[model samples]
Target chain A: MRRWLALILVFTFALVAPGTNPRAGEGQAAPEFTLRDIDNKPVSLKDMTGKVTLISFWATWCAPCQVEMPHLQKLYDTYKDKGFMLLMISADDARSVSRVKPLIKSKGYSFPVLLDTDTKVVSQYNPNKTLPYSELIGPDLKVLWQHQGYTAGDEVETERRVKAALDALAAATPPAVAPTATP
Target chain B: MPPTPRAALVTAAQALLLGLGVFSSGLAAAGEGEERPEVSVSGQDDLEFRYWRDDRTLPDFPEEDHLFDYWELVNRVNVKLDRGPLQLGVQLDAVGMLGAYYYLNDVRVDEFDLHADGVTFPLPLAYANLDKAWLGYQGDSAQLLVGDGYIAFGRGLALSLVKNTNIDIDSSLRGAHAKVTLGAWDLTAVSGVTNAQQVWQDNPNKQQIRPDHWHMVSGLRIDRYGLGPLNLGAHSVVYSFADRADLDAQPWEGYGRGVDAAITGASVEAFGVAGLDLFAEGDLFLYPGGEVLGVEDNQPGYAVYGSAAAYPGRVALLVEGKHYKDVERVNAVVSRDLYEVAVGPTLEYERVITEDSGAAVNSNDISGVRLRADVAAKPGVLTPSLTLGLFRDRELGGLHFNRAPETIVHPIAGVDWIADSVHVLANAGFRVDKRDDLPGGVSLGADRMAHVDLSLGFPIGSAHGEIGGDLRYFMWGDNLNQQTDFTLLTANAAVHLGHGVSIVGYTDWTDDPLIDSVGNINENLYAAGELQLQPADGMTFKLFYGAYRAGIRCAGGQCRMLPGFDGARLSATINF
Candidate 1:
């Protein structure tokens, strides 16, 4: 009887526990918070309304991050015109600001880079205890998906998610009404 | 409060059963999947049952008598579900260990029972990796997984657990993971916490323990866009430790001041030429108190590594080189993980002459070069493997390839022959340097020593029961004004006698020389045997009786505090 109770307790945790990252198809609003970018400018989550958002938390010295940056830039470039915004929050030290800015320039990346010098945004939003994690937020302010780690196969999936989010937003926006409607 | 023995026994039993159940589940899964051509499991259990007579070595210390017992079971199940699509599956293992105190060696330094010292029953303790599970899916086109897992990037100078899991700490994370690949581009991401074993144990004890040690990681890799010979990968992390107080209180040891964002770095690797591939990576860590630390300290650590493998028909030759700033073990807060640089070069040769009979030969040659300043020198542990290799520095005694201080010269040569179910192996090396690190000053030419070993192994009968034995010897030349000759002979045999029972035994004899810092020899002696039996497939009972002049065990080049036992030991591993 005691063993049965213990097993039941474990099953309950699996079902109700808030996992390391958000699960797909979970109908819940994404946590919102504000953080300052590298330029010491406020990047508010609420302000990025009516557009799909990709928030990536990263550090400068990570090996996998070095491999992932170019593709992220590509994703930003391809869908920037379609109301898609990619916010990269770097957890690097403030001293690294000088180093990171140069790295960005050398790579010729144009995406908006934010600095979480204090790591406040990570704690409030996802509280990710692991690294190389990404989140896709729908324009409706719900967490569409969340995942961790980087591998050779993740690039294709990220692209598909980006395009799908854009399509969903486009469909949600009503077409322009005819001018004769006023008459 | 009184120490009740019954409660401790019950917890131990629970842990044992849970571990067995998990092991059986994995075995059952492996038998079901045909797609998995190779399925295997490795399991180990360590249990110490003893009655304490005293906690000290001599008569001066107080004496206490009590029955103390604990056990740990670790089982890993791996399956290559499909090679064509490259699907890989692994289970982190079910951890079953009980009681407030397991063993002197097994106890976590910080763990403690909150009850009164004399009381034992209903011992308040913490557990890890229980009722935890994870799954991973991998393929050429795409991959997906939802379960607890682990991730590491680069050489682990920044984040590297995808390989080495030597450290007895949080190596696996509890979370959901996924990755997808398209042509030359690949992306991956994971979300999890430090240890899945702890799971929700911190909930009810939230005030005392915060369960919010959570994180999310994502990155991508692109290679040879067909535009140019280029490769790139990047990683990012969003993490938060629910309880930062513990980290905040620790002293800044060059690594960092804060817990969150302690390990954060970036790298850019490239490939060129047919045989040459190169890489360079760096890291940055942000912490509280307005302090920033690099990989080891505030200094950015970088390295360049390359390898060349040339295959002339079926015979192949390969050489790999790694040169990086060394991460100082002590005073990391003040120094970069790597300061002075060292280089390692290894050449390996392998070939197969007869494919049908499975006859093959393999060999490797190794060399290392070090550049260091006087300030980086520190006393470190000694490892026997370094003596076996030919190339080693005499001026530095930190030990091992990664921890050596000052200049080092070391090389290794080895050969292996395999035919059907039979195999033979032998390796020899010589190492020397200018430092007075060894017990003796340069007595032999240029402070160098020699190590050699040989072994032969084969299987018998239709069941492929394995039996093997070998001999190894290490001779230290009186190079650094010191002299000692050490020889170790080990013989091992394993036979499946009948039914579910198997008998295995091994004996080791060693001739060691005791010497002082000046290389003055003090004593020379011999030490020798181990016998174990598995009555059934589930439990392995072992009787280890050995007379050792000295026994030493080390991890990460760090030596553990082990008492020299000249008598006997009884041990067992039981799995359901």
Candidate 2:
């Protein structure tokens, strides 16, 4: 009887043991990293403090990512003035900067093209190594939500999530406290 | 306790029951309230039957001695919930198939089992979303999640989801992630592993096959800046995977990196001139070992894809061009390879035809220039659109793999009777190939085929009834200096009684010149009917029957290798 009970316990543990990552949900601080864009300018995660941020990781070869580029432009237009900023990063080879740079010019995307030629940044956050992933972070640098895979109808979800995060932030900020006159 | 098979059976049975019990428990919350406790279930099923008989028994193609039968059934279930800041979900699907038309044997179907936490099914299939689920926490400004999910930055030219469902594959990430947003910039970092599932397995021991694990890490940062009528944006996605000796039989170190950028702008009306739109984007991938993990490499594997559809009142011209190269690189990463190059331009002219009767139709005349090269590198086809109403699709390439060039010439034409809901369509085309270079026993020299089809559909009673008929004639001329011809007629009726109830029935008949040596007229007739009922939100029950008059049966691009079959089919999908 004891042996059978022990076996059952072991099986149960196996079913529940796999998931163990720790970088999402509420109250969690984002991981720190610094990298350079395609133009060779250094960029850091800490630089965008105190503002809402939309961080996206993608590669040029992804078809759906290509389709969603113009839609991202729409979101940028609607919320940029409301403290919404986006960080775009790539893990392309440093040698093909010429190829990548010219192609970027042709597509007409309005986002900066940072480079992680060594892939140091890629390994820091995206473990599966798949491309075209996005994470939405609030003004306080907390990751509000993240999603993977781009289908025909994903733009709606992306817009809804971004707007929700922005609204929540807007609601939390207290109106400017007015100075009281001395009696 | 000497490890008897019965005990193992009992233990396995207990686990199975436990899982099913949990699944039913989740289904117990189906009423429109508080969101069903975060559990979701979905599924699909199909069944088919065919029958065939030959007038003359030829040596090469002998008639079947008995009737053939085929049927299939499948079911999928999922359950998800949250634990404090952590989330979890489990999914399972079982498939059962049976057919004796091709070879006499037992049913063989694949089994799938998936599990995750803190994540939801992405798009497409909500049951497949295992992207993120792990121990994590979130505050007002920053948050972290660990497990499986996807990330993207800029245009995902060099990196993106490797989603191709036709062959059935979904790339998933298993790892840890961190994100922080401030002002106009967002920063995120993640690390994990993939290829944790064995690519192939036999049914006897398929469950034991575990995915191969590889360590990977990546980070991204994006900042948007712009001016009036002009915007300049930049983003980068960087990732690296630790080399695993087991990844490949050969010894080699592996790592990957990529970057994408864009600049977009448009003119304002202030100048009284129509705004001139301008934009550009690109991506570069750098991974020595990317090929092993399904990442394309070299030749930039790049694309400069864009389109312009400026609107000026009732007229619009849209033009788009995309250039993809190093097509083999994608194949190098994964085992499958499909490459294509195409450029399409469309001119749409739309003017309100009539406004009184709610009748408005826009006409679209499009032409496409496409070049497709399959694995054989032969039959490099060039297809072009022709005619204002019917788009003529022709294949201008040699044959490969003893297979005829697909869609020698297909014309797409349709006229709407009552706007978009009711329509009539007619298409006629000719396809011929004189390719003398074909495998013996499969050559069709001097062969030509022409076909015409007309179909019409409209609402019958209320908003659910639909009636349609299709008539098609195929004429094969001068094949090996011989003539072969055939004609087919079909009629269909469908009624949708709302409330998830539908009934559909169709009958088809065909006549053709026989190819058998004995020489006899080839005749085929079939009738199929199906009644579908969905009493609840998550359940579908179908009762179908089919009868065929000794002829070949093929439909929906799927052809059974077995002989013709005749039988009844029943399928169902239940949530609880």
| lDDT at position B94, candidate 2 | 31
Query: Cα miss at B199, model 1 (Å)?
Result: 14
User: What DockQ class does candidate 1 belong to?
Assistant: incorrect
Candidate 2 per-residue lDDT over residues B306-412, each given as its tens digit: 33333233222223333333222332323221110011111111110011000001001112222211111111111111222112112222212112222122223
Off by over 4 Å in 1: A1-183, B1-121, B124-147, B163-170, B174-176, B190-193, B196-231, B236-297, B326-405, B436-449, B458-490, B496-501, B510-576
DockQ of each: 0.01, 0.03
Q: Residue-wise lDDT of candidate 1 within B204-268, one digit each (tens)?
A: 11112222222322323222222254455555443333333332221112123234333344544
Candidate that would win on TM-score: 1
- TM (chain A) per model: 0.81, 0.78
